[model samples]
Target: MHSLPDVSLRYGSLQVFHSLEEYKESGVCKIPGAVTLGKFDGVHIGHQKLIRKIMDFAHANSISSIVFAIEIQDRPILSHEERAVYLESLGVDILVECPFSREFMSMRAETFAREVLSETMHASYVCVGTDFGFGCRREGTASMLADLGRQYGFQVEIAAKERLFQEDVSSSRVRKALAKGDMKLANALLGRPYPVMGIVQHGRHLGTGIGVPTVNVHPGANKILPPDGVYASCTRLPDQTIRTGITNLGIRPTVGGKTRKAETTLFDFQADLYGQTIQTDLLDYLRPEHKFSSLDELKSQIGRDRESALAILPDECDRFYGGPAFEFHGQG
Candidate 1:
């Protein structure tokens, strides 16, 4: 196993390869390097720890840090585009996105270790979760990788498991939290706010008539919505400006609404956002969606929700959002 040193952690540049052939064509990852492999669905705290360790080792050893990951098509936490941006924020130099197909899934553990990690990635060191397993039918384990590292000439390190709320933090557990509308738990495990990106779409102008304007969004498919509720949100508009607001993720049960969507009441915000993409960082879970006896009653509740949104965000939201989400780590 190769030894490594300590270095200050900071994110630098990023390059992504959609295929192994494209990666080799770029003439990168052809020499010994530090690599971390995972699906990294949510890019949660546990995943961050592994990536940071690998990046640190790479920086210390004077080699490139590559993220060799599988892009799971079904029910993924973050899309490939979003995941690449997040990994770049963590200082990964190269991102090797492998298409998760039937043939790739059927590849044996030994073949993956020898062909992909050893030959293609030229991995000098590899870091993965304690429960890490891969290859045909989940036949590989952390110990199996460690043993193969000796044969293939690379070092293996199992990331220490992280815990919150007295349970192991994991992508599955995070999804469960979102299902239960526990934003604190979900966001805590994610190491950042739950990210939901969508394009602003037209909806019934019910709020406008009530004197409260809202932006309706059509979320990208497979985005897990949090239990149909009202939440405090940090929104990024298409012009690259950040705004704080309150959002409702529901079928609009109140006033006989239909279809699942998110409506945002951007505080002191006035703009033409129709047909533009907006990314919302849900910060705090407020209240669950409910049907009111009348539109006036619903309007009153929204007025109160608006006041609460103002108090939840930082005093200067514009400056706060200018930094990476990782800066807001720990229980607050």
Candidate 2:
């Protein structure tokens, strides 16, 4: 087994494991669980429904609720750290971030169920989507999983697809909405504002020069972002305080900068935030990023953006201010 030193981290009541080996090594596997497995890309409404099922089953049966998050090769809608935070907020007891190793991927579906799910994890029950697949080459189906569950002395629940506007709610759908800069539709599908989480990094101080001092964050390469634009945003600070802001997410073309970053100027706030991990929720798209004629022109547009952001952010703040307390574990 591949043993990693930083195998797990804790967030309040939630325990996160990097792999099945870590979970077994940590002895958390001794506690039987109601488990669900998925990529859980965005943890949107569809994913939430499946999670709720496992949580409820675990609670009723006096077992732990486990989410086996398969780490795939595709770029994620939410990064691993962000997904961990979201799962913690959702009250998951154990989140196993199972790496998609070639060896593990080649395991037979029956072997996976018998060894990993039954023998190792000690799952009392399992939940998954109706279209779930497993095993090498995606050969396992929901019915196959059910049969394996019976053989393995576990119960299986396959949740129906969650739909919105007569279409299935999925990570791909959310990505498409973001790609088009449709914050409204994306938020509607996600059942929350789209979030960008990162550490505050020092920038060129251009915003300060223009009298708008901003906090800059580089979204990682794998994180999918909305089309480069100005957005009405709500930022949650290190102290768990939420502040309204105007976020410009793009390569600063007028400044001749090439890196894509989110530079947010928080309204009515003036505390240094360098190196702090913060979550900025994009509420509404204001406008596409534009290169202005001069610094003065850029500053004027930012002034207008702040006003527009303020107008749009109050209601958003009211909605999400006290909803969930997100803690950054320095995983990013």
| Highest TM-score scorer | 2
Supply the TM-score for candidate 1.
Answer: 0.82
TM-score of each: 0.82, 0.91
Candidate 1, superposed: residue stretches over 4 Å from native? 1-13, 19-32, 238-241, 253-257, 314-332
Tens digits of per-residue lDDT for model 2, 1-332 = 10111213445578888988899899889999999998888899999999999999998988999999898888888877777777877789999989999988898899889999999999999999988999888888888999999999999999999999999998899999999999888988887788888889999998899888999999978988999999998777766666778899999898998999999988778888997788888999999999999999999999888888777766665564533353221111
Q: Scored by Cα lDDT, where does model 1 land?
A: 0.78
Q: Which 10-residue window in model 1 sums to the lowest lDDT?
A: 1-10
Give lDDT tens digits, candidate 1, residues 104-170. 8999999999998999889999998888889999899999999999999999998779888788888
